[model samples]
Target: MKTGKRIKGLMACLLVTTLMIPNVAYGSQPPYSDKAIQRVMGKIYEPTTVDLTGMKVVDQAGAPLNAELKFMLFDTTIQEYSPEVHANNGVLDTTTLIKGHHYILSLADANYEMKNKYFTLDATGELPKDDKTNKNSDSPERESFDSITVTKREQTLTEEELKKVNRIPFCDDNNGAGKFVSELSGTVDMPDMADMYINDYDVKFKLVNQYETVELTVDEFGFLQGDMIEDLNYAVVMETTDPELQNYVLLQDLVTSKNHQEQGENVLTRTYTHYTCNPIGGIYLADSSYEEGQSMIEDCTYAPLPSYSKKSTLDGIRVFIDRGRKINTDMPGALFKVFRDEFVFNERVLEETDEKLVMDFDTINMHRDEICKLPHGDYTITTTLPTENEVQAVYNVDRAGNKVEDCTFTQEGSNLSIETTSVSLYNTVIEFKHVHEFEKIDGTEPTCTTTGVNEHWKCTSCGKLFADEQGENEISLEDTVRPLAPHKYEDGKCVVCGASDPSITDPENPDPENPDPENPDPENPGEGGTSTPGSGNISTPGSGNASTPGAGNVSASKKGATAVPATGDNNPFALWTILAFASIAGIGSVVVTKKRKSN
Candidate 1:
């Protein structure tokens, strides 16, 4: 019997410990103490300051309940047959109520309830309800009790609140007629949306009014296509040239002062942007890592009113291409040249749209050939216009890649044209189309002469030229010249690989020379001293022409040695020395010959 009792006691102790495990294992520790909760418990009775206080306590009789109520509303229930009570009433626990984001108070029973017997208690809940015991039999027509209020807690902004973007993304849609166009009149800024909206919808319309008009807009999918044949002030138009005009123009939000020009006050310039588009919805996601989509924009997308630019030129057409490069793809066959020397374009215009860019080509394809041929060194094709003109083009310089246009060129109002040319695999392009003021500027041959230079003199006049010591002679001191024909480098030849043709190497002139060499020899076998076209130094045999008794002139090749005097009838020893010392007097014995094996 004692063993059985001991076993029962141990089992009871195990059961109690097992039940306590849950309470101790994962329950949350309240950040505040019960005393902290009691400090602000007098809020339920003061109707005036009800919402002002964060937490409150109340009694069963609607009085200021004692702060020492160490209980919480664990659950709620609804009692209804004909007249239904709140779903939360007697329907859930404190955990579920906190989870659902709201709190409700209700009575436990209907007939057993008194008047105002609905309010319950949770973590600071009030007790507006009194039990049937509190209600006397004379209490006429008992009324049900229920109420709901904010839980007095902080929360994160909802999706809708974040979408508001602090009202920054909203248009001045007062009554909604001219909302998008009215309030915005500035530059560009880009900010990420906290949330996205209707990404799959498209808008198709032809809105027209006094300020703006959409000729024809057909957006059916995720693509954008619209033609706004709008009349804009030249200055205003310039300020909104970027494709993301809406985003960019937000930069204007920072301006505090501006002289608002009345509409139609000035007659300056015009802008026309046509939109021809083919909707292509799904974008090429980076994670996809597939070579998808059309190779070119034209193939996959359509733009009836494709974007373009009217880049500013000094009043007339100005050329801006080198020997074989072209401008603007807009006019594949057209080129640019400046009529006026320099000017500044309107910054606002470029910020608004790139259509005004005169350079028909994106900076990426300013030239048809690969830029790798002439890695982005300081090579520019420029011409002086009638006036002083300057331009700054911001662009992307990808290695072995063409430049990507990224900025607008601002210039003053003047007639200027930039020169451009178009070329391809077969048919070459050599035409001039003007920017700013569209007047054709003819391209004359580079009015300078190109003479061939070996190692010596430059031929200002047309003739064979060399840049070596043996100037324009038929022979070259260094046998090496000319590239390996077509398969060669851009700036002459590859020094390391010895890969080039004669066009890059001028064995007779301007040969490559080494400076601060480890071994300084006038005749360096290294590529550093390979003879170019215009190295200016040559050697020649002496002149042996002279009358009797008059010595012929000659210079010795070895430094510090005097020239040999010709032996004639005047000097008897000269002849005898040659015969008597015949063993040592070999022909041309004054100098030692240098021998080298060829590579």
Candidate 2:
């Protein structure tokens, strides 16, 4: 036993000595130094420096990298990892990365992107096989450090960056998939409702009354969005909330038996769906199929009613069933009128509703790795998204996160769209004011005096009386002002004043320069007036003959006992006879004087 123990001890010493030879004998090696890089989830880290300069790789102590973990590469290792990198398919297998080489790991579909094209030299070197084992390691780590260079690292992503890189829009587009249904129906029994896929009704209303339904369909921009419909299915039923086929039977019967008398009492129902891009309007079938829906065509005739049927529904879109159809452009004038009215309502409601449900989808779609797909070069990335149209905006968030609210990058479904058009603010202003004109406006009726011309006619309300001192067709204002004179004859003289009423007021201080005294109204022509002598007090007869007053007529005296005739023609008959007698006496006296003188 003693001999055995000595031999065993010698053997152990030999084993220890052999293990120490590599570290001590290799004088050019560094002092017991080693390095490692920790890789996780296909990502590599900076190499960890360990004290392995004076030791072999097998002598690594307190290894940060576990020996059982995958060892990608070493310079002298003769092992190879299987599975090559495939850039096209984005598969990063063990063969994609050289073992023991510094590399970067990224979470992306591009993890399989191949490195720059380079040729591999066949140096007749055996790469380390990972499953191989020596006395120290049974399955050695595959090495890549020998021929590898860490020139540059591919860009890596954070958790957030990873989300951006891997995100794809899934069901982000609002599939306006429920446009075939409705919540409200109308009161008109239009048989087209069957072709319109109307099977239920929520609010049935009276005829000609309005009912609105909010349909979700692709708008003019051609994407799923909210819209409105007005009176699509006119009915006159006391509406209920049933979705059965029989919900519209009574109305259908009335419509099938349509007549002028039947119209007042008939009703129908429809369960409205959100509207669609191409509205489900009228349909046309071959004229031969008239017998199929003859009752509907003949009875429920708005125009020359054509038959129709419900066709296939593709992705919730109800395509029409125009079975062997022909064009019906001039279907009927009356039908066109109804269609025009309803279409107006339809467009109006759509315009109003697009503004209400204005939220768009682009604000949520994110840009991804594909954005950087060009050749390696400098670039600046931006993102955009959309918001609600409750506010008028030139800007919005785009499919990416950058603020592109300017709507430049915005597409149809990317913005809160109002409609195919921009709606201006509706402002109806009505102004009320009296248009006064100093004179009558051209083409305006010339107003005349409303008062009557009869002598008894007076405006008792305004306290105005009419005058009958008549003219050819009018009366003078002076005559109209006061009561008319009792007689109509003048002093056989013509009047110069036509209708002007001149007031005769005496002037306080008469002046030749000013026509009026007491500052009479300038508009009045005769407020202050001048008077001249007439027949009274100074009237002379024809050819300067004076008129003497008689006893009862009353004469004036000029300081005389006997009244002198004021007229120059005043003469007495006694004065005339005395003169005659004096002439005879003078003749006789002359004759007598001559006879006496002769005696």
Candidate 3:
């Protein structure tokens, strides 16, 4: 047991000796011998000369470069010692660096961008990657000091120099495979006619794939900048929010460059060009039939046509008329009608609604001299001349007597568009001289066979007809035709004008040539008279009257007239005389027989 204890004491002494001697990999000299390590370990030391040699700037392709640049150091371990340091001949001084702590070396310049490199000055420093170590490391016995160059690339710059430039953070916590943040920038340019500043309107922007919108404030030159998530697949959409500005001013997207990350760019920039349009209008009138009225316009003086102001809106416009040195109602038969001009599809009007007339002439005539409110749109105004006057040529002239090229006139009237200005009109009238020379047309009575005419008057010079003799009311010639009247007949003839009727016949005085067979005459049996005469024999009136032959003959005549229906005959009086004569003969025969009986 004492031998084992002696062996253990020997091993313990050997272990103490091995610990006192420094390993060959750490360094042969004591760590406190270096002033930088002494300062890190809290030991007092004087500063030593820094070693900064044999290092140089290079491009991505490993080519040596000549450029004006700057340098900065960042501490990655316990918060300590971050400073803006300078590089002498492309190498940094290592004497002030802390031992065993990680650092980031940043090389900054306007002409080139250097990526961050992790480095340390002391031999005991730990590296992030096992194989890729910085060139600044120094150790005599470590045998594994393989040096790999950091990648470099050339980059263009803005107008600012290194002092004012914002460089990327070294060993930055906010950068990784999935982390991306960047600035969006653009310039807005407007036409000179807009007369507006970029700050006068509110601008909003949104990403194509994003639903939220962000506000961007532009400076005097319309330069804007904002922070946004970097995206290669998304595009930016920008617009002005003022509702009134949208009417006359519009935004034109000239350049929208997406995929800024793919292009190795930091900020996405766009160019916006704005355009503007104001309202205008014009008018035309022509009345060559009245030369005197035309001369009146050439002699008058009035204000120039009104142009649209910047303050004008879509609903704020006026199209008016002025009668210089004349009464408002001087032109009685003239008509001015205003219809919403819908013929053109300013953008696409015809495809929407097909309606035109807004204010007719009758409504417009009531307010001839008052202010009329008109919207800023396409319009058609029809000016109808009086009956005595005719339109020959229409000219759209300004107050200075110069022709207005913007407005045109047609025979029907004028079509005006109020896009950039306002318009006005003037009119006058003159009566024509004429007289009516009437020719009287007498009326004729209507007959059964012919049409008649009503009394009317016709103008000889104008060929106009009138129902009255004064010729005040005009009528057509066809209105004077009268229809035929019904025929009135008496004795088989028209009583009105003595016209014969073939359908009617007189039975008492029948025509001898074309006698009716149904009417047989008594005097002549073949003719159509009352009946056949004296055909039947008569019986004796009494036993005594039968002795006389003359009395029997008279009685036979009476029986013949009675048998032929004398009451219905046209000569019934002749039949009655025969009956009376027969009666007288019978009485005389009876009286003579009485006298013979008495003797």
Candidate 4:
């Protein structure tokens, strides 16, 4: 009887030790270890529970609730949720989790009653209801509870349950009207929603001014088409009433058509967004991976239902491509590339409606009429060809084909700007002008007779000269000439070029060399004269009296005179008389010519 009691006592001690094993194992480590937090923040955790594992929650009726679950440690001392332990989306890993620690599993659900649910894990690593006896309550109405006996269930939703959840993928909308039509046909579009099941439902149009409901069938292209009543100023609400779309959040449900009669038909578009809410109970800290004192789940999922009652003031744009006189036959065809503007916020592009403008050739053909619907923003148009085929000017035209004077566009080489602000089909005429490819023409060096041109530029294809490098300032061929230089003559012959002066009668016999006027010969008093043509001195024929060369010249008529023997007689007197007569005759001829006139 004593051995049996001893064995029973040993078995009871082992059971006690087993119950305390959890605390002893977790005691050495800090509460809410950093490694567990890193797993919760795997790169970046989305608000949805799709990435979470190990637990599945259900409602009171045993239906699986698509709720976001968050596991947090309870501080026994404070009697509240603590930062010591945290696991996102009910991710319970037995190897990593602490033993014997009281943990609270909170739920974030759309249903308000189910949102306040909390579960606890006891000393044996089993989840059980928090009974009110432990300062907690099984009744969800009571805010706080501790001990309660409840059923523990863990199973994922069946395929049928997932289908019933009904989450419609968010669709992107250009938020602008469609193509221009001849008549005012009302159109409704759900952009990028062709493949989704919700797109097959009919759109309901409720006229507010009149008690009428019209159902428009969705076309094969996944859009609604109908015509608004002519000239009836009744307000219309285009919406979806299908019960399957109850969970989807409508982002935008209406588009205001401006000048529908003037610019033809417009399209009314819709936007729907889907998201799963995240739990919002955690002590946010500065050192945590998320924001300080804030929850990423709450911030991301919080949004009010979108409402659209205001009038849409959208504008339409029409492009007229004028391939102006392309005179050069050798040049290839010119192409203009269009670019829609993008609006960015916080390093993210918020709006970029269309990027396929350049991809579709028929849409932006050279001369075909193209009318496009665009949001109110700036746009750029540029040439795809080389600089030789650049845009000359861009004119904003009216419906009457006349240029609009109110708005002006700027052109920087090949680029042109356009801004849509009004309902006018603001005709944008892109007139392409041929640019000149001017090459530098080296100038020719001028000579004495021929004229040469200065440095200038000439068009490679067309023979046109321009003074400036940009080819703006045009110049004539004569304007670029370096004038002919005159012949520099010295002693009846040109010094620069060896050409004789035409005015000289006989260049070889040039005349008696003239002496320097500033210097006088010492032998001849106060006289500056050159030497005779053949000799330095003139020897008188009759007398030995040497007439020193003075300011007098022997005439060319006396070139062949023979030297007579010195007679020392009347020959010297007669020689002076003959020279005096010759000088007088020569002076008379020059005077007569000076007074003469052309007949």
- Identify the superior model by TM-score, candidate 1 or candidate 3: 3
Best by lDDT: 3
Candidate 2, 1-599: lDDT as tens digits:
00111233443454344334442221222222112111211111122222111111111232221122111221111111222222111111223333332222212332211111111112223332222122222224332222211121276445564433311111111232322221112211222222223322232322111222223233233222232211122221233464442223221100001011112323211122111111221221111223444323333223311111111000101112111111122221111111111110000111123222222211000010000001111111111122232233333222243443233222233322211101111111111121122221122121122222334333333333333222123334444333333222234322432332223323663453464554344443222331112212334455343432332222322222442334345456767999999999999999999999999
TM-score of each model, paired residue for residue: 0.15, 0.12, 0.19, 0.21
User: For model 2, what is the alpha-carbon lDDT of residue 65?
Assistant: 19
The candidate, 2 or 4, that scores higher on TM-score is 4
**What are the lDDT scores of the predictions, listed in order?**
0.23, 0.24, 0.34, 0.32
Worst 10-residue lDDT window for candidate 2 reads 363-372
When summed lDDT is taken over every stretch of 10 residues in candidate 1, the lowest stretch is 251-260
Global lDDT of model 1: 0.23
Let me know the TM-score candidate 4 reaches against the reference structure.
0.21
Q: On residues 1-599, what C-alpha lDDT tens digit does candidate 3 reach at each position?
A: 00111233443453345444433221222222233332432311122223323355555565544444566665433212356655444333333555444455555556656545545444323322221242232332322322223343445565564543323211112221111111111110100111223354554533332112334344444334333221111123445566533422112111111111222454322211000010111111111232453322222211122212211112221121111111112222111111112000011011111112111111011111111211122333333222322233333333344544243334422222222222222111111223567899999987877889999998787788899887677888778888988778887789877876666756754664446555344443423222233322422244342333333333224323443442333445876999999999999999999999999
Per-model C-alpha RMSD: 36.0, 37.4, 39.6, 33.9
Model 3 lowest lDDT segment of ten? 273-282
Better by TM-score, candidate 2 or 1: 1
**Residue range 1-599, candidate 1, lDDT tens digits:** 00101233443454344334432211122223334322212121111211111233333444333222112231111010112232232222232221111122222321122112222223334323322322331133333233222121134445564332111101111111111221111111110111111122222223322223332322322222232211111011112232332232110110001111212224211221100001111111111121344122112121111111233211211122211111122222111111111111211111212121222221111111011011111112222223333333433323233543233323343333233221010111111221132222222222112222222333333233334433434334233233232233557655435556455545454444533343245343212332211121211224243322322222112343343433333446766887878856653364333222221
